[model samples]
Target: MSMQITLRRARPSDAEAFERMMNRPEVHAGLMQLPYTTADFWRARLAEPGGPAVAELHLVAEVGGEMAGSAGEDPVGPAVRRRHAMMLGISVAPEWQRRGVGSALMAALCEYADRWLGVLRLELTVYVDNAPAIALYRKYGFEHEGTHRAYALRDGVYVDAHAMARLHPNPPRPSPG
Candidate 1:
């Protein structure tokens, strides 16, 4: 493994860099449901209205000691019954793709999901044509639930997404030592 890259909670300082990655054209093409968002909108989103949830975490991967990637989760719905579930979002800088960053973030999200919130399921949607991200989701044990046809319009045309979820096994406890 690449030990030089460190993964941790996204601090306020890392917000701008993370937003930059989110705004990248390839990232927008592969990951988003719409066009690039304004910096202010992204900043507010990263600020987290209340704060980080143990389960609803925002993480960044620092490589060579610089912010290189990010991942996050948020309540999937406003309804009380759906609070136990969260949505997943992950991104690694173009230069950092296929490195350990995405895996590290997924591991952290799973840990937080099971142990912190006692969540039963965690899910995400990836563009139907995004093969690499789909592979990554599968590696993390997310099963494809189904695909939504033309769920999003990209470049004035429709695109689809595959919804996937992982129902975790029992969460591991931290070592007492």
Candidate 2:
């Protein structure tokens, strides 16, 4: 039998469950101290600087009505210069890893970018040791832009991350008849 999964935009109310999903050991190990992030951290990230918050679009994959996985696109900035790009993050629940949930969320995000955001490209950074994630990014057409050596200190040790980007394929223009 197959797992029943559904994808939808994430909301502030889903905060607690999302935090729980992030606590799995494989997730904590692979992501490097991720489970250490407090629930308040996620709350702040999902919101803005004021008492209210900045609005951002994030997606979650729900399996059997539980928060199973998540993916999000964080716009670089409102500066006209930076509007063309957005950063991405993805996490699949431990039980759902290697299943179709991650791929489905990725596909849906790409579609949203193409149809709604007029996005010229999508980008992300993946740590060098996370082979599965690197494979997934490559499979979805993201190319390695470069490696930021010693980019982050994970568990007191530095870890490098590879920057990647996927540009929207341009459609051919019509020739003068």
Candidate 3:
């Protein structure tokens, strides 16, 4: 049976669940990270401040009331000129793959970036072999910027990654002083 998925901003209380989901072999492998994520790290990330001035958004996807996936978007740099672009990261549980959880998380993040935060560019990097994630980003208008060889080390082997980005079609107006 199919499960319903919902997207919401992540909370500090979700640290433990986030830690568990991210450490899974399949999910962590896709993200090119060692299985060393800690709950305290997630808690600190979730508790950080974010709003119009700084559009850091950490989002979670829930399936049947359980955390199924997570995504985050934050400025690529802190300089004034670089605030228009944001970097993205996402991960979905093994059981949640092929479902709508990833899609929902992407949609929410893009919406927040384009409509709410007025961000002009959204960027992310995915392992070259992660076809499902690459396809999902393409569906959201992200294009391949280029490839980085030996960009990440996974299980003692270097892997290539594709840089992808989406430009907002109609950005929101900046807040006036």
What are the lDDT scores of the predictions, listed in order? Answer: 0.79, 0.78, 0.89
The best-first sequence of candidates by TM-score reads 3, 1, 2
Write down the worst ten-residue block by lDDT for model 1: 46-55
For model 2, the superposed segments whose C-alpha errors exceed 4 Å read: 32-34, 47-55, 171-177
Model 3 residue 115 lDDT score? 76
* Model 1: per-residue Cα lDDT over 17-58, one tens digit each: 766777788777777634566666666766756554434688
Q: For model 3, what is the alpha-carbon lDDT of residue 133?
A: 95
Please report how far candidate 1 places residue 36 from its true position, in Å. Answer: 4.6
- Candidate 3, residues 125-176, lDDT tens digits: the string is 9999999999999999999999999999998899999999999978776579
lDDT of 2 at 174: 48
Indicate which candidate wins on lDDT. 3
Q: What is the lDDT of candidate 2?
A: 0.78
TM-score of 1: 0.86
TM-score of each: 0.86, 0.85, 0.92
Prediction RMSDs, each to the true structure = 3.5, 3.8, 2.5
Sorted on lDDT, best first, the list reads 3, 1, 2
